[model samples]
Target: MAHTLAQKILQAHTDEAIMAAGQIVRCRVSLALANDITAPLAIKSFRAMGAKKVFDRDKVALVMDHFTPQKDIDSAQQVKLTREFAREMGVTHYYEGGDCGVEHALLPELGLVGPGDVVVGADSHTCTYGGLGAFATGLGSTDVAGAMALGETWFKVPPTIRATFTGTLPRWVGAKDLILRLIGEIGVDGALYRALEFDGAAIEALSVEGRMTIANMAIEAGGKVGLFAADEKTLAYTAARGRKDAPLSADPGATYERELTFDVSGMDPVVACPHLPENVKPVGEVRGVTLDQVVIGSCTNGRISDMREAAEVLKGRKVAKGVRCIVLPATPGVWKEALKEGLIETFMESGCIVGPATCGPCLGGHMGILADGERAIATTNRNFRGRMGSLESEVYLASPAVAAASAVAGVIAHPGSL
Candidate 1:
């Protein structure tokens, strides 16, 4: 029987000989992850089960990113608890302050996740791994604890939706715009419990980093996962990272519940307005709207490619007066690469504050929280109410190009405006 990439990957790890959508099946997990905010709870759950140790320490990753450097005494205690658990379990991918970064970005860079793998993390952005053709999804802390102890978990196979892209994306119009437009067309609950499979020439042309940006936000549209099938690009990335994993692809006649097509050549830069990632509109539709802050970071768009794009727009300009601009590198390694490439200097010289690899500001962790009535245009995934700070604050989601341009104008702007 022909199967979609998601089904194929799931079957490879599943014990049953035949599996179909909606069928509950137990499958082996290739990787399981947890972060500072969720790891403590998962660890507590793990201990309560009286599990001797993790199923496979090397296959689990623990990252201290959500509140890195410790937000307060409670956060510090949580971090300490996570550290002890990781140490006790001999976790091979434990990341702490200074080296910690958003787990979604760090895992891919380390080659800890790859095609055909079943990965689960205690993070909505764990879907980011699906960009590499992995069957990845996010789970709760208790589920994570169960996976840690058993190395396998049950899943209700989600039906698939294939979105094919055609033509080249216009200059300044990036993956973020494409995704935001998709969310707008489909709404926040569009793909509830469904797998979104990306394909076609335009998707193939996108850099893995760009695909990561799109896959990272799948949760915004209520997708079970969003992925690009294994192709030459997937192999090249894995090889470059000095890791090897079998690439998987959907059969030619694989099934999908519905299909959508996008023509990037005619697309424009888009932004998701305050309160919902699906409240999207073209930049021109909301141009000149004032902003209180601008941030370019998160697991979504804080990689080297994102930094380079933002730096280009800010090369000879400064962040608008009174509008703070914060630049976060997605990982320590990404930070070092950006620094060596002079992107860090370019940002700082342009008056944008360069921050560590932590996921600060994106989730109201710290460093750039907003005050009441404040509005920020950012490259992070979500833009829900109070996502960055006070309940009255707002966030607008855009591409690095739009973010950089808006930062220079102190309002929502576009790359063409710059």
Candidate 2:
């Protein structure tokens, strides 16, 4: 039987000569990642397992990015616990303060993630690394602890759902829009426990950063993993940093549980409004809906390409009165690159506050909390209840272009409206 890219990677990692959907396999992990919110729990569980040391210290990366700068004493203590464990384990990839961004966004930049690798993280968005052709997914703290100790974790091979994007992607329409459209069409649980593999000419034309945005949101649709076939863009991104990932592809006759195709020509910018990431609507449909704040950053849309897109829309323009716009680069590296390109200056001159590389407002940890009855447009992953602060506050998920345009208009405005 032919195999999908995910199956191929899994079969290679597992002791088994073959792996199929629904089969359980314990595959060796190439990388293990955790953030401040999950690392402490993983460490505690690691200790409970009577493990004297991690299976591979150099492969584990513990980052303090979710509540960066330490939201408070409790958050600081949580980070401290992870730090001590990392120090004791001699973990080589530990990231502190300014050294880290969101683990999903930073690992690729460091050349620590690559194709055909089995990567797992304690955070759901870890699948973002799948943009590089790796078979990556998120596991619970206990799963992480188990993987940390044994260098492997059990997985029930998920059936693949092939989503093919054809035609040219319209200007201002990005991966965020494409993924949001998918969620809207299939609902949030559409791909529950399924591996979503994206392909076709449109997806092929996407930059690695754009592909990362789509892959990062696969979990938002209940996907086990989101992947793109590693192409030249992916190879160039990793190879320049002294890493090389052999490209992998699904066999021509690979079977899929379900198949979907989207024709993206002239696709409009879309948004996922309050209460659910699947409640997507076209950006023009939400025009004039008042907003108190706009956030243009997160693991989902905080890369340099996203920054350039936002800056392009906001350049020579000022934010609307009574509207607050906050922008965060995904990593310190992204921050530096944006500064070098003057994207940071454009944002700041437009009345947007450019912040450090942090998850910040995306998880309501800190930096830009919303008030009661306030509404914000953000380029983050989730927008469920009380996700950004008070339960009364609302968040609308959008692309960085929509985020910037909305900030300038003080509403959920479209770039065309501006």
Candidate 3:
């Protein structure tokens, strides 16, 4: 039996030898995570469990990112409670300030996740760790509290579905476009409770950052996890991040329950418009759609590479007179690197507002809110109605390049056209 990355991680953690789909199985967890918004609730639930302390404080991580810098009283209180709990539990890995960005972005950068590990977080984007060949998934706050007490969690083995892509993507086509297209084809709930394994030459050609972008959005399609096998590319990425000795890859002969094939050689850049992530249309079809705001950052596409790509498009071009553009780096590390590379200067020269390294407008928290009837084109993962602002506003989701190009044109435009 040839198992995929998801299968290997599940089997390694399983207490039972013969696990079947839909049958609950107890499994060991390599790491557990909670951020400010969810950590307070998880802590409350843990106390209700009457546990002496966390099963292993070292295995738990607390990150204050969702409301970094604390905007309102409720958010401030959440951060305070999360910090108090972390201090009392003696959690070794606690991230705050600019050190905390999106939980998924900070986890891999801090070496908290690695191949062959099973991680759980209270944020849906936790599945981004699957890019490192880890079987990571998101859970409810109560479920995280249970994992904190027992160091284990129950899971029904997910049916594996492999998405194999062949052929080179076009200049403007990116991982975001590919995943959005998949969501369009499968609908929002098509992959419910299933493991999505990406394979083939096309996937192998993508960088780790690109792969993370794909895995990060799997939740929007209702997938448990979007997994990619660890090849040399995976090894090199972790190695560069100071985890040179980390375990890597799944065993050969891994089994998959189903497979899908995509021919993206001629694929066009896509836009997930108005409300739903799955409501995708090719950029060619919607190139002239006007936008009031354009954002180029999020857990989905907020890495240094993503910033650089957008910066390149913004250079020598000012944001459209009436359009406001916001650029947020995913983490302080990414921000510092972009600064060192002069990418920050390019963005500022183009009249783009560089926000703090946080989730920012991706979740409609701190930046670029739209007024009634206003429209935005953003690089964030979801464009669900009212996600970025008022219910009357509209959002179109695209790659960072697309967002940047659109910002300069005052309308949706492909990066190549810039």
Candidate 4:
């Protein structure tokens, strides 16, 4: 049977030689992840299970990124507990302070993720690793604890859904638009518990960063993973990161339960407007939409490459007169790299305020909150009704390029002209 990338990776982790959708299967997890927010709960549960140590100390990665430099008393306590738990558990891959960032970005960059592996993280965006042809999915804290105590987890092999994108995307239409369009077609719960595999020329034309951006939002569409076949771009990315030995591609003739085709040749930049992440519409259709704030950062598109794309459009321009634009790096490593590349200068010169390498406005804990009737265009993942600020405010989600261009124009503008 021909299997999609997600199917191939899932099958590789299964104990059975063959499996099908809805069938229970035990999988051998290659790696498990927990960040500051989830690690404390996971540790508490693991201790409750009477586990002396993690099944494999090196197999688990504990990162402190969410509240790194702790914003409040509760967050400070969470970080303290997580650090103590990691050290006591003998977890060798603990990352704290400046070392912490978004878990997904750090994992692949550090060569911790590879093809044909099953990776799980407490964060929903763990599906991002599917870009590497890995069977990655998000789990709750209890699941993380179970994986810590026993290096295995059970899954009901998800049915496969294929999205074949044809034609070339316009200059401003990016991976974010592609995913948003798909979500618009299928709605939020359409792909619940399903594995989505992207195919065709359009997907192949996308860069690794773009593919990652697409995969990172799989959860928004209720998918287990959103994957693309490992191709030259994937190989080049891994190689440049000094992980030339990672596996590549799935077997040809992979099987899928269903498939969809999208013709995006002339597709315009799309935005997932507030109230729901899946409420999407083309930017042109929603032009003149005023915004009070704009934010560009998140695990979804906070890499150096992503920042450069946004900076390129903002080089000689300034943010809209009254609108505030906040830019954040996903990780300290990405922040350092951007500083070295002068991207930070470009952003500052363009009148964009830059924040530390924290989740920042993405998670709504700090910075860039909106007032009633206010609107914002952000590069972060979700746009649920009250995600960034007040429940009365509205958020429109787009790519880094679109967010940057909109920030400068004071309206929802495409990045194609810039």
Which pairs in model 4 have colliding backbones?
A: 2-253, 2-254, 2-255, 3-254, 3-255
> Clash totals for all models, in order?
0, 0, 7, 5
| TM-score of each predicted structure versus truth | 0.99, 0.99, 0.97, 0.96
Candidate 1, which ten residues in sequence have the lowest lDDT sum?
14-23
Q: Over the stretch 147-241, how does candidate 4's per-residue lDDT look in tens digits?
A: 98899998887888889899998887888889889988888887899998887899998888888888888888899998877787787777777
Model 2 is weakest, by summed lDDT over 10 consecutive residues, at: 11-20
Residue range 91-142, candidate 1, lDDT tens digits: 9889997767878888898889999999999888899998999989999998
Candidates' C-alpha lDDT: 0.90, 0.91, 0.87, 0.84
Error at 369, model 3, angstroms: 1.6
For 1-418, candidate 3 gives per-residue lDDT tens digits of 4456676677789768634556677899989999888899999999999987988988999888877778889899899888888999999888889577777888888878878889999989999988888899999899999999999999888887778888898887888888998889888897899989887788888988899999998999899998988778888888878876455554576676777899999898899987999899999889999989998888899998799889989999999999999998888898899999999999999999998877767787876788889999998988887888889999999999899999999999988887
- Which segments of candidate 2 are over 4 A away from where they belong? none
In candidate 1, position 156 carries an lDDT of 88
* Best by the lDDT measure: 2
Question: How many angstroms is residue 138 displaced in model 2 relative to the true structure, after the best TM-score fit?
Answer: 0.9
